[model samples]
Structures are given as C-alpha cells and as structure tokens.
Target: MSTATQVPELSVRVRDRLARRHPGALIGELTVLPGGHSGLTYSVTAGDHRYVVKAVPPGQRPVGRNDVLRQARVLGALAGAVEQVPVPGVVAVDETQPAWFAMDFAVGEAVEPVLDEPEVPAATARARMLEIASVLRRLHATDTRTPGLDAPEPLDAAGELERWSRTLHAVPPELRPGGEELLARLAADVPGGMPPVLLHGDFRLGNVLCDGERAVAVVDWEIWSVGDPRIDLGWFLLFADHRNFPQLGHAVPGLPSEAELLDAYLGDRPALPAMDWFRALGRMKMAAIMGHNLRRHREGKHHDPDQERLPPTIAAMIRTARDILG
Candidate 1:
C-alpha cells in the first residue's frame, strides 16, 4: 500500500458500520495518522467529538471483514484489567469500509523514534520510565484471561532457545550470520525463568508517549500478549539500555539510570550477569521481524521508510549481538 495518494478516504463499509452502531454521528478530526506496522489510523471528529479510526493492513484483510472489530473487542476485554498506558475506547468498530474501525482518540504525543530537533531531555525520560516500570509491574500482576494471549510457560533456557531459534530462522538466510551464534550462547545463559507474567509482544520505547518526560500513555496492541514479563523486560533492556545506546540516554534525560530502573523492576538487586544477552535477544528478534516485514516491501507489496530500513539495521543488529555476546 502506497501513501502516494490522499490515502483513499474511509470506504462506505466503515461509514455504514458507524451509522448503525453510532446512529447520529459524523467523523471529526478525520485525517490519516502517521506510523504503525499493521494498520492505518485516522484522526476523526464527529459532532463536537474526536475519534481514532483504525484498520488492518491493506493486504492481509481477513475473511468476513473482522480485524477492526476484533481489535476493538480485544482491547475492550482488556479494559481496566491490566496496567497499560491507556487506549481510546471503542466508538463503533466497522468492517464494511475496507477493513477499518473507530475509537475515541487518546490524547498525547507518541514518544517513539524521537520527537524532533529540539529534542526531549533524558532525566525527564527517566522519571517517565519509572512510571512505565510501575505500569508493567501492574500488567505482570494481572490475572485477566485474554484469549489473544497463549498460556505462560517457564522462560527457562530451553524455552528461550526454542523461541529465539524460530525467531532467528524467521530472518532471511542472507541475514542470518552471527545471529545464530549469539542465540546459541544466549540459549545456555538463562534468567532462571523469573515468575511468569504477561508479555507485550512488541514492547519498545517507540510504543510509548510522553508528556514532557513522563510516559502518559502506552499504545500499540496488535501483539499485546501473555507470557513472562521478561520478554517485555528483555526488550526494554535491549532497546533502552542507555549504556549500549548512550545517544538515546543522553538524548532523553528524564530517563532514569538503568540501574535505578532495573532495581525498581526487580524491587531489589538484579541477579543476571549479562544484560547484553537479553539485549542481543531483543536486537535479534527485531532484525528477524524486520527481515520478514521487508520482503513485503521489496516484493512491491508494500512501501514505507520504516519498513525499508530493515535490511541494513538487521545487519547492524547481528553485528551488535555478536560483539555483545562475545
């Protein structure tokens, strides 16, 4: 799907869905939103109201036009049950309009990939992160039985090995160099399966929002999941370990020091010897995800800068994993 044209306005199908569900309504602040992997978002306002219109990937449309409804249903089920940053409530999910749905727009600037030239401070970033840790702790403590997630398993050495091996294989063969070795070393290096908890499938700094250095909201639920919170933990440690990516730490000051945040996460001292292994795992998983995602772009199936950067970044991550694991 190309963004070349005036992103084909919401089709009649979505409009009809809204008409039936909402009765008297008109779309307000309705415009295409930027950034997302599987879908497009629209800023909508109807009759003194604003909402976010969501849809599934243009090509992977499901039979019976259900993604938009499915997404809203899943989120609704999770309401008040977990410790997420907060999302818009379902306004009226529609399936008729070319695979799209709608929700009241949550207010806040996305804190991902970096905001702009003026740049936000790191210390403020730290303070916000403490809030993030607190939220994750709440999620980890939740007992909601969401069907979207599979049951939790012990994140033992063997499980990590099996999981990453599959993730590594998902990477194109051309992109699989030192990744295997790093995964091998990491397979043996385990965290003793810290008590099971939910996993935010694609948790990352980019999925958050900041009101000055405090994370006011967390978005993105395509992969909201269940498993060891460690998956989310490992992802953050890899993606936000300011030590490995000092530029990020320095770039965002309110961000808490790694030690302080980890201590808070564990509510005590950390026992893992090498945070790098988890870092490697996170990087590898991203690289592999990128590889799978890029093929769609390369095959004239999709076009997006975010998707395009995968090949090279995948290589960079492989190298980083090898260096850190070695």
Candidate 2:
C-alpha cells in the first residue's frame, strides 16, 4: 500500500483526468490498492460511481506490462464480447508520463481455490471451479488475432520455456533444484498443433472476482498475451494440488480434482496432446517464480518472510516436472 506522501500527485492527476470523462461529477479520494505486480493500483470514487486506477509507477517508462493503456486495450477488446467471462470495463485513460487507465471496479470477492469464505458452501465452491473452467475454455476459443492483442506472432511452447528460463537464470541454483534439467526436458519435446489463443497467463480461482458460485470478472491482465491455451490451462491446474500453493494449505473443502477440472474445460472439445509437457512447464514456471522471489527476500530487496517456505515447494515442483517428463 502506498503512503499518503508516496504518490501525493497521483490522486490529483487521477481526479483531473477522470473529471473529463464524467463532467460535473464530484470525485472522491483515491485509495491505494495493494497486490498488483505491474504498477500502483487504486480505487477512486466519482459522484456515485467507483472505479479502479492502474498506472505505471512514477518515473518508470510505460513499456511492456506496465503500460496500463496496453492493458486497457485488452480490457476494451474483451469486455462484454466473450460470454460468461466478464472483464472490467474501460472508463477512461491517460497516456501521459505515469500512464494510467480507469476501469469499473469489478464487484465481488476474489476467492482462493480453498474457498476460504466460511459462508460459501462446498457445493457452491465446486460449482464455481467448474464454471471457471468453462469460462477459460470460452476465453481460449476467442480469436487470438483480436485487434487489440497487437502481437504479430504467438508465443509457442519453446518460447514460453525461454521466457521463464530468463527468470530462472537470475535465481541461485540451490533454490530451484533441477530447474535447468526440467527446462531442457520441456524444450526437447515441445508440443505442436494446438492453435494459438488468448492466454490469461495466470488464470485461476484467485484471479477472478466471484459472486457466489459465479465468476463475475476475470481481473489482473498484467501478464495476458497471445499464446498456446495450455500455458494458462496448466497454470490453473497447478492450483488443484495444494502442495503447489502451500500458503493456501490443504484439506479445505470443495475444489475439484485436476482431472475433473480438465474434463470441464475440454467439454465437447478433443483432448489436447502433450498436456503432460505443459503441466511440467507450469511447475517449472512456478518454481522459477518462487525461486526468484525467495532470492529477493533473502537479499533484503523484498521483505516477505512467507517466501522462506518456498524452497521445498520449488524443489517439489522441479521434481514433479522431472518425474512427469520421465
């Protein structure tokens, strides 16, 4: 969370920019929102309406995922077009330095795989997971060549491996045991034939805003891109096993087994080949991510003690990837 003094000008600029969109509306305070990796997120009020503000951090160039307007393009393209799966509506945008965009604050809670809400019934939680699976299937079915996606070529399986490998290389080897071997295995047997689709990059129960058993909005487009659908599928499937996400713990009722979730996703579609490779790649990606974060934590650059528990999990993911490959 940003302190009042941190980005004091942010609120003023946001209010000024938003005012153009909703003339005569009285804009309220802008409150910093926590948890996004791309940039500073905030919730602001204007008249009777509330909106979310995703912006490039102060002084940083708005390139890659930090380009909030790029994300806004995605939101604009997908909003209200895909059935069942809804993303936030783009309300306004400012492409200036510290580029930002305001979107309708998606209404609902972001539920974890465990369905941590005590009031949500087990049946309801299970239903939500299946619904999310269906939503993912539909999302992938959408044309990858959608105008705003902007990528000339899709990121294939090997390219995906290389992308994460760059992150893995930054971490000390001990943190990610067998990570290189796992990457090599994934690369040697790159899957082919699956058509390119719009990938959420980190699609899962936790990323969606839900109302009861329904996923109202799929939030967090920070890492979204055009790629093989399995990249997202495998990532989402990793959550089915509690071990991959130890922070959520095990034995929380109501989530579907990974097989059931995949079945739901496939529905009438044929089974995707080389899924084992994709699954292994998913584990490797997670290991790399955790390992990098663990290194950061150890180096005192990012202070999060919870990352300490990640070494075993990272090792486990690499082992699992190797085992799956073998």
Best by lDDT: 2
Assess the local accuracy of residue 224 in candidate 2 as a C-alpha lDDT between 0 and 100.
80
Q: In candidate 2, which residue pairs get closer than 3 Å at backbone N, Cα or C atoms, i.e. clash?
A: none
* Candidate 1 segments exceeding 4 Å error: 1-26, 57-59, 63-66, 82-85, 94-100, 113-118, 146-177, 190-195, 241-254, 268-277, 290-316, 319-326
Global lDDT of each model? 0.60, 0.81
Which digits, one per residue and each the tens of the lDDT, describe model 2 over residues 1-326? 54335777877788987787679999877787876677878899888889999888888888777878888988887874554458888988888787888999878877675524444566876887888999999888776566787764787888888889899989998887788788777778888846788888889888888898778889888878887888898888887766665554455475798889999999987888888888898988888888998999999999999889788788888998899888
lDDT of 2: 0.81
Global Cα RMSD, each model: 5.0, 2.4
C-alpha RMSD of candidate 2: 2.4
> Candidate 1 versus the native: TM-score?
0.72
Best TM-score among the predictions, by candidate number: 2
Q: Indicate the residue-level lDDT of 61 in model 2.
A: 83
In model 2, the runs with Cα more than 4 Å from the true position are 1-8, 80-84, 114-121, 246-248
